[model samples]
Target chain A: MLNYIWIGLILIGLFVAVGNDIIDEVQNPYRNGEPFVSTVLLKKAPSGIRQTWEGDLVAPPDYFNGFYGTQRTQEPIRQPAVISKSADGTASLTMNITDASPAWWREMAKSAGSKERLLGRVVEFSVSEDQTSARVQVVFESIRFVKLKAVTQAALDYAAIAVNIALGLIGIMALWLGMMKVAEEAGLLQVLTRILTPVTKRLFPDVPPDHPAVGAIIMNIAANMLGLSNAATPLGLKAMEELNKLNPKVGTATNAMVTFLAINTGGLILLPATAIAVRAAAGSSNPGIIIGTSIVGAGCATIAGIAASKLLQRLPRYKKAMEV
Target chain B: MGEFLKNLVEVISFIAIPLMFLLFLGWGLIKKVKVYEVFVEGAKDGFNVAIRIIPYLVAMLAAIGIFRASGAMELLITVLAPVTGLIGMPPETLPMALMRPLSGSGSLGIMTELMKVHGPDSLIGIMASTMYGSSETTFYVLAVYFGTVSIKNTRHAVPTGIIADVAGMLAAVWIVNLLFR
Candidate 1:
């Protein structure tokens, strides 16, 4: 299923890039003959050339809004490149705002209406000496696009991501899975199972009351609740394996498995410590403020997951397969 | 009120990580289980599962790279922005919404980028972080877990998972606006 989507993306991207005149033929480093690499500029499109000048605005410049249409209709804007400021006024600044789409670029160009409206408070606004034109020449540059080189580069970067993921998982997986083993051996699974029985039975009517899968599922959910992902995954796989043993239909997901998958994907977060850590590292004045919001949002997701899973099972397609 | 809630969560998390280990070990000893051997056995299983998932992870991640590199993601977001905007989603956070289900690292990267552009305390940053915290990497989880068991026909899992993801994204926008904005 995903294979088709992957191919479609590559093919469609190539087609679109060609049509949009974004596919640039570049010299292939490996080949001696011709330009083998086709680089497509996706997001970075130059709207137009602006008179580049350097000076402070008499006051903060009023942001233009036309390019951003409405909440739904707006195109994404690239973060403007910052110029290094000097104590003396000599830094170069470009008023041209390149956008993701050409339409937005045109909108930006049109929005730079009058000098009195835009540059009244600005100390300096002039065209750079490189160009003879005083008019703001709209130049479109597409920053985000897909090409063979980018696709290959992106694929190559995955190896590093894979290694990092594995490396990060090793210690956590060893520790958590080991402790989970201890929990199971210590009868904590049974304790947790009993505690979760009522809820699990309602969600998974197919499973028997005394099945070991109930315990495994409960423990998996518990680990997830604590943001113990290293443990949660192995435990989840373990639970799925146990559930598979009970499944009469091979290669097809049972109701219980689908429900579990949905719940796991819903992922109710209690602390969101990672996000908070990121906020703190990023210099947020109040890192923990997001925690309450996290709970509300995740709580809604989990409830939605449970409801969807349960309701989905009742549909004719799923209900018709019920084991007597 | 927000401060109190934050402190409460802080206290619980601080105490929980240690207590969890203590409870497991203590119970194992009390039950007279061979805790060390059982743990070793389970860790071996964990190692094997991790090895097994690498191929699935590669497949999923590679697809994500292609999709992202193609700029298909931005296209999708642009197409959906209007409808999403009506529901309170900011256009800036659209990429994260699209990426959250398919790839974890991808969404995290976008979240980090958004936080950098708009300060973490900004509305966009809070919304991105909230969405990040609430949703799971749906396709990644399904691929790895289903691969572990070799489930060929996922039946209704995909739609169900997507439903949850959409719900999470919407809730993130709503909750952040209410609490922070």
Candidate 2:
């Protein structure tokens, strides 16, 4: 009956995926290649001490060109900067604004009605004089505001790809888990459960070592440790459900279940392939950081998880349960 | 439509060619492989999982779009600026952080923009790249995992996943500071 249910779910999931247009949308690439041009006009004073500098930045030129690809009068202005040019073309002019109160970028963004506000206070400028216009290279030393919308957008795009890949793995693992369920119904899980009896006894003192819940917990943890998080979740839930099934009366948390959740949550595994793939996709110069960090982070999380679980088990309620 | 076709061609040229070669190698090394059967089975599975998570994916995508449309993400960066400064992260990285959770391609676009804006070697540009490589989409993971298992208790998962994300974010900043700053 369970086997049939599993197969049915898989079939239904597949049917829906093909029937819907989500995949097409996800797989479809969006072309956003619009030329952006920023111009700053500066008028030089005769002595060159400094006069005035004004600049305008145009982002996503396509947006300025209306939906019909025609130019519009009111284009979205991203960052506007005003600076003063130094008297001598060689000297840099610095502007001090410490007495002025600095406002939070978001507050400014609210008034501007945009997500990002131009950040940077003018620190200095280098001027070059020509026949018609004085060209100045303005240096912006610090940002007053930073907007995360673009970064978050990038993260989401990466996650979409990751989710797609993870889903593929989940589909395969679901098949494997289903097959494993068949093995269990045929008594394979029981045999494995007995083989693991000693460790299970030590690990889960609150639950009877021979309980079906123990087998389920072991299988669930095994799946999680393999980095198949989606596959691990259902197995872990089923284990908890089976454990609950054993408790005829339940008002308190069990040491075994609590410990199981902690371990499953902290399951340490390396996904170098995924990390490297993401790095390559994101155009990283070094992809090895994924490998190095995973080893360190996963190691720490796993240890902390074990320590937390052990400490929780030592609590008075859990200690008393163990004693019982 | 032409752009879409061009993108399709680029994807095929970039991803499909390499994957096809890898598949060929696998087939040559393995004995008695039912190539067509395996291909059909894999495709069927991919199609299935994609369908099962459609609503969740759509919700996430739409939420991302709205956030972009509404300028909430930009607001978030403004809110985080002081903290970002204390950590020596570039303000330009704001967009990359916002885009990372919603879409990979979108993040790539942001990263490309950053590279153009900051010349890749700039501290913020490097940090943005690092963060891009370091973190995962917690919400997307939650949606897909829960959507597939039909488990609704996101109680512990959401908090834990976000904690990991914060840690990843800090790590990216700290590592960049140590290496570059």
- Provide per-model DockQ scores: 0.46, 0.06
lDDT tens digits by residue: candidate 1, A211-274: 7788878878877877777668877887887798888888778889988988899888677878
Tell me the spans in candidate 2 whose CA falls farther than 4 Å from its real position: A1-174, A182-269, A278-286, A297-324, B1-65, B92-135, B144-157, B179-181
Model 1, position A132: C-alpha lDDT score: 26
Clashes of 1: 19
Candidate that would win on TM-score = 1
- Give the best candidate by DockQ: 1
TM-score of each: 0.71, 0.43
Query: lDDT, candidate 1, residue A214?
Result: 87
Instruction: Provide the clashing-pair count of each candidate structure.
Output: 19, 37
True contacts kept of each: 0.63, 0.01
For candidate 1, the per-residue lDDT at A128 reads 40
